[model samples]
Target: MKLQQRLIRLSVGVLLLGLILHVALLLGYEQLTYRDRALQDLRGRAQILALNSAAALAFNDTRAATENLQTLRTAPAVVLGCLYAEEATLLAHYSPSGARCPKRPQPAQGAGSIRHVESVMVQDQSVGQLLLEERLPTLAERLPRYGLLLLSVIAAEAVLILVLVVALRRRVLIPVHDLAELAARVTERRDYSQRVSTHGSDEIAALGMAVNRMLCAIEEREAAIKENAHLLQALIDHAPAAITMKTMDGRYLLANQQFAEQLGVSTEAVIGLQDIDLFPTPIAQARDQADRAAAQAEGSLRVEEQLGERVWLSERFPLRNAASEIYAVSAIATDITEQRATQASLAQALANLTQLNETLEARVAQRTFELKQAMDQLVQSEKLAALGSLVAGIAHELNTPVGMVVTTSSTMSERARELKAMVEGGSISRSKLTEFLEDLGAGMSLIENNSLRAGRLINDFKQVAVDQTSMRRRQFDLGALIDDTLHALVPLFKHSGQRIESSIGPQIACDSYPGAIEQIVTNLIQNALLHGLAGRKDGLIELGAHVSHGTVQLTLRDDGKGIETQYLPHIFDPFFTTQLGAGGSGLGLYICHNLARGILGGKIEASNHPLGGATFVLTFPAVAPQRASDAS
Candidate 1:
């Protein structure tokens, strides 16, 4: 039993013992008083009978004496009565109804006359001695009835004691039992909300009050613990790095939102699941090893891992329970894909700078001799510069068609592989071969269509390249250029479940390189769709272009996960990419920036949108109207 039950039992036992003792003492006193009063009544009756007998003897009338003797014989407590002369002769005798009195001893001369006897008594008289016997006949008749009455009183007292015991049990024992059960439940469940109720100002009530206060304190502490847990969970969920908690056995116990998203799975699906369940082969083994290292070391462990095309910096820390036992391992991963790329790029730049320094040093030795033939050298330099510009223009023009060809070839190869699988699986039966052939013919037609599309892009690239190399200006609709760029990138966005909503106002003619503007818009839209939507399923890309004042402004925005505030400053750096080896060239944005400023004569700025996403703003100067005379 718990302390509460023990206390109640002790208190109840003491109370019952005290009550029994009190009742016994009271009953004993009552019985003693009743016995004393009965004895006194018997003595007084005997004395009165003796006095009446003396009066009868003093009259000396036979008939009156006989009547008095009869009256004494008929007395309730008198068993026998008689009248006699001084010599102690029996004048008249009477016995109590249905009872015999014991024979009394004769009184000696010196012996005291029988003043009081348990049997008979005689009174001194002139004619004869008046005798009276004290009989217990009346007492005998009342004895059985008194015994029955005493038994009834005892039975009533027993019933009252029983009722009191039951009341005490109900009021005290039952509540104490309930409180004990509640306490047991609190211990087992670790839930401290339960409390006992006290009804009145009794000791049990005071005990209940004390218990309730203790429970309140425990509950308050439990609430504080829960609040702390919630705060910690919130912090983990909002953390920028991918965080996960795994058991020592390599089962995931908890994962933050970013971790689940990075793994391309739901948090619920990842919990209690081992790495092998989500990933294949070496990745699972690597994760298991890391978890074991953390547990064995009883400290933090860090390792760099390459999963697919991205590199991750993973740190694991041993999570210990209250008993200092290793319960789990907490792993935090930072996608260091971009950082690794930056390091590689820095190394390449150093090599290039070294090469450039070597070239400069080689040319420095010939500077004094070249000064005499400076004019001829200048002429040769201009020719070489023009040739270099021409080669750059050709390379730029060829880039569009090469990109188109590569995209088409990859799509065709994937389709061919699918068709081969269908054939091998018998999904396409011999009977359906003719239909398959027809489909193949249609696919060839599609290839031709795409080929022409690539040619058109090539033509546009050539025109823009020629214009850039010749330093020629032309009038072109900015809205039309944006529309063309959107059309070209529509297939890329379509596969990713993204829709572009464009709000192109009335055509604003601009005197600039139209191809450069198209390239800039294409790079911006592709970046928004890929990086912005990263791991998201559904997203929207909006492109708004219009004439603001004399400048044409174009805004491209996407409703995807926005970039972190810390990374905003480094976004425009050359060869920087959030996506490193996952088909990111890093030159897309760099080329776009250069084209916007150098060719389109525009300024571009990027910022996080208020609604939650990334936005790029581009402004181009309006084209000036030229007369036919001025053109001539």
Candidate 2:
């Protein structure tokens, strides 16, 4: 603020603070002194009255006590008084204001009112009590007087300060304001030649001289700055790179001659123009994206782009202000079309030579790779063929039960037809009808059994095939499933003088891929009958299951000529079967091994028992690994 204003504010603030404190002290002192004197005066009057009323109270003279209390009228401030007899009876009371005497309660000692209670005694014996109450004067009742006095004092102080402020405004403030005005002019016009007038020999005049000297220095520095800026602008315009400044939204703020020429426009036309207005849609979009990327990155970004026949390598960096915040993007684009063309020519020459040398080697390597891929495809095809053969065997097995069901059902229909004819001809007999129903019941039972057999076979084949194909995990009753599979293979051993004995528990359960286990069992059984018991009679194949250590142990042994000692090690190898000439395909054991290790996530081994038998044991996790839904 101006000197005069600051002086006035300082004076007024000091006066207001002093006045507030003075008024508070005066109010406090008046209340304290007034309350103390009023209390003492009331207590003295109460004591005197108490002494005088002691005689009246002793005699129980109500008239004398009343007369004694009536003297309280002389003290108009006493609102009420009371006299009590020796037995606490009210003998006399007085109220100068015509208000009834308040009940003689305990004296309430506080600032607002004076309550004095003195005991009345005669002959050193308690007689009566006298109470006097007087309301003290409140500050509010004398506010006008104190307020007027405080105002008078503040007014006198304010007048004196005003006179001093006026003098300072003329002697000091005017000169300081002159210096300030000169500084303001220098700042506004940027012409720092003006000097403040030195009107007096004082500190303020000296300050005026200092300000004029500062302006001189500033003027010289500004000239140097202007010259440097001119040189910098010239260098920027002459630079080979096409430099431009643009907002994040792609609007050009400034552009050099080279940048304008690259866009085939003048600098004036380039400024305020967006990329889309100067370039094709694709190029414009690319440029805009680069600008936005630089802004979002809050740092520098580089982009290499092909525009028409030229290649431009542009480096865009964020332009920050005094606050170190990115406000715009500055891009310097260099044309690299000629350089790229030269490099392309060199590359073409080298590629021609390299192609001649690498053609044969590349072809050879590619053929090798192709042949390896073909072999892998062949192996996969063989696996799929084996799976197809298993499906075909299952289909063949299903045909028998389905054919039996069809044949039995047809026979039952014929029997029904015959019975209907006999009834229509009225030649039906009781014995004949009974025999017919019995046949019908047998036929129904046959159909149900066959249908169920077909269903079970289909279900088993489905689960096995699904697990083999996809390796899906599920919970299954191991014993029951094994029994069902054995039953399904009953026809194979029915007339072969062979027995398949199972020593599996009824409650053995597993949470794994049952289909994989089924496949393994089927292959092992076929392998045993085909290899170990090719020509033997009374062949016995034993299968057993037990659970331990979180794994299911399945053991299958055959009582026949055991596997050859030399071939025992390769027993589970693919295409290593001795009966390969008899259409063994050599994949059964290999598939079993893979299913156990990969699908069922387990292991299997083969050994020759000392008792002339080949035994195969497979162990697998009771709980299979979780199935990946997206597994191919």
Candidate 3:
């Protein structure tokens, strides 16, 4: 900008000087041309005067010559005119109306006026001389016009100069100044992004382009440096170990994300903080000593640091400056708390294992005895569960009969009381006596029938417990025994919306454990009632028995929802029940399986009937496998 200002001042001064010289030269040339025109006119007039005066001089007519010279009065500024004889004498002279005329050729002091001399000849003889003086106007008279003209010229040149100066400033000075400013800014601020727009093929433009190239190189280097810094920071932040760098005095200079997290603070907060600011005094002192030692040694030092419940394998190292002097210390910490705990746990577990090995046999024997007791209890529970079902059926079956018997006995007692009252009143008529007798007989019959039904239900249910507890065998008719067992389980289906049907041969008898047979029958019936009959409105339970070859073939089936296909294989598995968490103990079918196979020596298999529903078939020797041990 300063250079541009200097250029403008210098250009203006030179232009003004040139303009002044041009105006002066124009004025001088105009004055010179004016003088020449005046001279030419005066000479022409003098020649004419001399021509006229020649005739006068030849006759010595001075009066006529003077009269001719007076003709100069017709022109302005012809201040003086003279016509003289060639003998160094003035023959005639004329003057303007109020001006003096020079008689001879007077030497002019300057160009303010013009003087010319002429001679006349008559017939090639010198006759006389003619002299004229024309006075030029004074400088004062032309000064205003000159001054106005000069001003006009100067004004035009001023405009031209202004235009040229503006063009130069825009196209040259401004761009140069901008380039200089840009260079200063880039150098001072290290900002290499600014550019100067150079339009023309000039030196300044080339300089701008060179600066742009330099800026490009600088920017590239800056970008590469920033990228490398970012990558280094990223690596430190993502490292698994906690990393930190601190001044030799233990003031933190850098802390990666992991270290910040380990210290339970933000990365920004960790910076500039001494170890004492973040940790307990003892821990901080220990850490600070480690850092100082590492820096003094100019090498790495591995130290184990216990911070609260955590253990860290801290590798403290020194960071050096360009002068190879230790400036800071860095630490990379790997956590080993969990590893140490695991190692201790593994050692303790090995010790416990050795101790257990020494007493394994005794534990096994105790566990075996406990298992035997549990099995016995489980069997007892199963028997109790079957008895529970039997009791439920008996209670249901006996409800109707006991209620009838009570009603009939009450009616009979009421009738006998009425007869006794009539006899005491001595008004018992024959028809009344007959009506009372009839009512009593009908009540007696109802009581007898219902009592017998209740007795039969009780007898059947009582047999259930007897058969389960006593492993007695009998040559009982299979059909009668099944009927009796089915009768016992009748109350279970009475309100269950199921039909219990039986198909048996009358002579089919079994010498097997009746108790086991009873148990198997009760379990199957209970299973059908509880599982197959669940959620069913109407169902059918069919019991079939026969003697085939030397074995008694018994089958029970229900036309209820069958067991699921997936559960069919495990339907009889001990402790596996589809109705788990409900009321089912999962022991009914297992006990049935055990009793049939283990006690009755029978192979009982269950399957889904082709039609639908679950079917169980029991095939046992007609004479049980241990007749002597199970005889009734």
Best by lDDT: 2
Q: Which candidate ranks first by TM-score, i.e. highest? A: 1
lDDT of 3 at 79: 78
What's the count of clashing pairs in each model shown? 5, 0, 1
lDDT of candidate 2 over 147-216, digit per residue (tens): 5334333444666557656767887768757765774465456565677787655556655665565556
Q: Residues 1-632, candidate 1, lDDT per residue (tens digit)?
A: 34345444443443444443354554565555654454454444443333334434434445645655565533455555555544444445566564432343232211211223222222221444434444333434644434423333344355544654576587777766666676556556756677777787665675577567656755775578679889998899889778998887788889998888877888788998989987886988988887888788846888788888877778888988535788888989877676555444434534543453354334333332333243234335643443333333333333443454445445534554554555443243344445444443443443344344434433433333322322335777777767766665554554677788888865677776665576677678768766998777688888887786788888889988877888787776565777878855566666666566656667788899999999888887776333222243
Give the per-residue Cα lDDT of candidate 2 at 404.
53
RMSD of each: 33.9, 35.9, 45.3
TM-score of model 3 vs. true structure: 0.31
C-alpha lDDT of residue 288 in model 1 = 87
TM-score on alpha carbons, each prediction? 0.32, 0.30, 0.31
> How large an RMSD does model 2 have?
35.9
Q: For candidate 1, what is the TM-score? A: 0.32
Candidates 2 and 3, the one with greater TM-score: 3
Each prediction's Cα lDDT score?
A: 0.59, 0.69, 0.67
Instruction: Give the least accurate 10-residue stretch of model 2, judged by summed lDDT.
Output: 352-361
Please report, as a residue range, the 10-residue window in candidate 1 with the lowest summed lDDT: 105-114
